[model samples]
Target: MPRTQVTGRTGPRRALTVLLPLLLATGTPLSVGVPASAAEPGAVRLPVMPSRLAAGASCTSASHEVATATPWEQRSLELPKVWPSGSGAGVKVAVVDTGVSQQARALAGRVTAVGGATADQDCVGHGSFVAGLIAAAPVKGVHFAGVAQQAAILAVRGTDDRGVATDTTVAGGIRAAVDAGARIIEVSPALADRSRTLTAAVSYAAGHDALIVAAAVPDATTTTMSTDTPPRSYWPADEAGVLSVVAVDAEGQAPQGSPAPRHADLAAPGAGVIGIGPGGTGHFIGSGASLAAGYVAGMAALVRAADPELTAAETANRLTTTAYPADVPRLDPYAALTSVPDTATHGEKPAEEAVRLPEQHTDAGTTRRALLVAGGGGALLLLVVWASAVVPRGRARGWRAAARNRPTGTS
Candidate 1:
């Protein structure tokens, strides 16, 4: 069955307005794709800023050294708390982006190159960086720990030379991952076009109960040039059956005045994030909905680990329910792991017959005094009436006796 398509209110023109500021400041379009082979025809490749690690040609032996971490490492916010150790160990997370490097020491056992018929290998470093965010196993010597340290990743390359991810290539990569039995699918790419073939593939993944996470597209046009609204549209992410995510900072806050309705469902650490840069082990810090999407993907792995039987809808519900409400609230890990349905009903009750509860009685002494006062007043009134009646009758009798005595005396 075809899946439902969620149409976002933020169209292309508005996106351009919001994105114009960054574009003008950078003085060029942000190239975002890394293709496997020669550039595809008519594909626009945006120049992705290189990673800090990219300066070094080969992996260093010292990159494998173990190191102490920060408090974030101990908190569930940094790692998957719901999934037990080794639970998601075998589960593969298929990341459709630039391919992962086979020689990266951190990805030694965890990375699986899923290059097939659809897309090229990781020519640019964007896909590998996302892969690291999702499942980079905790290296003793590494600076950061991934969200799902044990979850395996299948890297599917989809970008072209202009740093653009095409609709056809992206759809092909998604289908490939589903066919490969990926338990979870993470997509950071949002193209300009929305096709039936692409939507159907995403729907198929959801129908098969696979959790999909995607980044909300940002604005693209320069805002300084015009008073008119700029383009602010994002495809695929705005599509149905995909959990859309918005960017948040380390303090757990999203951007201000972010386009409502089309904003991400959850927020995660986005600002000042440290990850591998293009083609090298360089550390790159970035802020965007893409990072937020990665956090949701990690959380989804945790959810699946906790309840493997959960459907895509149910899993989404858990994530949405647990998500801490932010400016553009993204997914919440603690809430998703522990949220329940709210059964509360609202509105006032209808008027009905009033029912009274038992009232408190006075003490025995106080009651006795009240009764005595009432009894004594009644007794005194009765006594006074009786005395008055007797007195009257006695007076009449005395008068009658006096009259009789006087008569006798005369005789």
Candidate 2:
């Protein structure tokens, strides 16, 4: 796919407004074209499998860099200082991307498929790479480890083998991750276009108080001719309540193709970042905005583990505000673990009382919509599923927020 200049959209999310109307009127399904660097099984070089398996094989020597590569990488982000307090224990980060490989050593027994079935397996290797960045176990002989070494991975496959997924599939993946008890969701695709399905899914996750960490720009792109018609933008990342992440190098400089400063919430080291790869590649170099997003997701996990009582937005706010610069913050795992949370509780007093936001939908209208959804057929099925599944979760989140903020004496 050729790199296109920005159109009126000015970011990666162009033509979404146009894509939504076409989906509803013509019922045409638009597919997401994941960047080749992020997807394509044949394109990704898997590690050479060992003839005989050892107890804890990591293949550390296969790496092109020195053994100290990973330690330096972690030090750049200041991750060591926070590991003792919270290695993301008791946190589940939903990875929405290519499926995760079950046999990746760093992720052995750590990955959970979203559905009850034996799915969420990765063929293209991208999802496994992303998963390792968030929560891989420490390799026996290598200096490498995930940012949130103890966090569990909720693997949800949105894209197919070719790294192509429809907006509907991506949306469903987000909802599934939330329902599967993921506290932090890592959306690894930077889709070429946008859809109502994806927007609704984003809202559903936010309403349920789940933090969304999304990859932006080059890691996600459109293979269609419309990609030539820019203001280039990437979806889900551009959506509200989602943390947009960009890739930086060890020097902390954002790359050329990443989301502009205005579009990104944080940056993390992605250039030459070492990650355990799919099909037992042990640990290798991976780079992109997707990897950067994975780092942020891991940080969110650490923050949530420090205090599972935090709301999604509250957790995200802590990470963003305490970053290295505080403004356009860079990922600072140490600060996320040590800093005071915005919603900290002390002596039974509430800090700033939460103002109740208006309900997403009035009761009568919701009931009417539910009835219509049940009565309708074909295309309406997706909407009906969302109503049945996401609505209740949203309501439960609201109640939880209310109870957390309820006055000490008032009934």
Candidate 3:
């Protein structure tokens, strides 16, 4: 089998425009002005963490540079608006990667190593960075935080200490995560070849009601290859019962030379992404499909926490169905949490039970604001009338929008 090395590139951050309305509607605090920390003199600079190390490379060092600006993904995902309803509480997400470090301060007291104590040691720092992207807690004065701050992490080593992954190790990691009762298993390795064992592992996870999230392509390639190399499938991403994720930048564009996967279920903020490394208050910059998978897994945790009754398949469906329409749908975490599924499209009769928000979690004012946001300040009655007329027509047309029909692009 032929292999191509994937590379990481940093892109300029663009401010997200659509989230402000939702944030105001939810009463989530927004920091419009620059923080005092950004102006401080002699701030420590952060390093870029490597996805893998070459032979004889020294172990990754801890970063001391703290990030003060909020990551673009935070604003793009509208995390603040969704945090009030679901903080991924009680959800167990497995990070099947190099390993997750116990020394990461934000992930302290939340990570459980699956294979052994060695599984808690992240020499490459890739696993620890992915874990931070999923569940790192809020730190005072730092704007960077995980998507699911309250979710528990199950660290399983799918790669060796130097960050090389094999199908056997990755297969075992998936099974281990399933056996550990993880609600969501995030597979960071994007192996070049598929294996029966890995396919079976994905099946086993689905059998046990675990949602498996995987990177659509390798984060970093080991050797240089031509940019025109045709796209290929990687596993267990190519396997059934998996949600394959690709990385996109703040501008919703994939990095140059990114391998286009045959079947990417979602695109997330992955390029030029900021995260914490092992044993650090500081942050590191990383990019690729693996990091994108982390974001999807965190969003899955939130959906599972928000609606505990949703099955693994149902949860995956909810995420894809509510995603912002695109060639490969862009993840909209807020929509995944709040939007009701369109069951009629699934050929199932609509349930008679009314969908109700938990009053204990949402006040009357918040509810009114949400309604206003949905209706664009029009009367709720008018919105309902519009939906009644348009929804049936949308269903008749198979819900195919003009955007979805456009030429497919990478990420």
Give the best candidate by TM-score: 3
TM-score of candidate 1 to 2 decimals: 0.60
lDDT by candidate, in order shown: 0.56, 0.66, 0.79
State each model's C-alpha RMSD to the native. Answer: 14.7, 25.3, 20.1
Report the lDDT tens digits of candidate 1 across residue range 122-170: 4445566677677665655554656677888787765553335778777
Which candidate wins on lDDT? 3
Order the candidates by lDDT, highest first — what do you get?
3, 2, 1
How does each model score on TM-score?
0.60, 0.65, 0.74
The 10 consecutive residues of candidate 1 with the worst lDDT sum are 29-38
Give the number of colliding residue pairs in candidate 3: 2
lDDT of 3 by residue, 270-367 (tens): 86677888886878766678999999999999998987878888899999988988778889988898897555645578668777788675898888
How many clashes in each structure?
44, 12, 2
Give the residue spans of candidate 1 off by over 4 A.
1-87, 116-121, 141-143, 218-233, 251-263, 277-282, 338-411
Residue 133 of model 3, lDDT score: 92
**lDDT for model 3:** 0.79
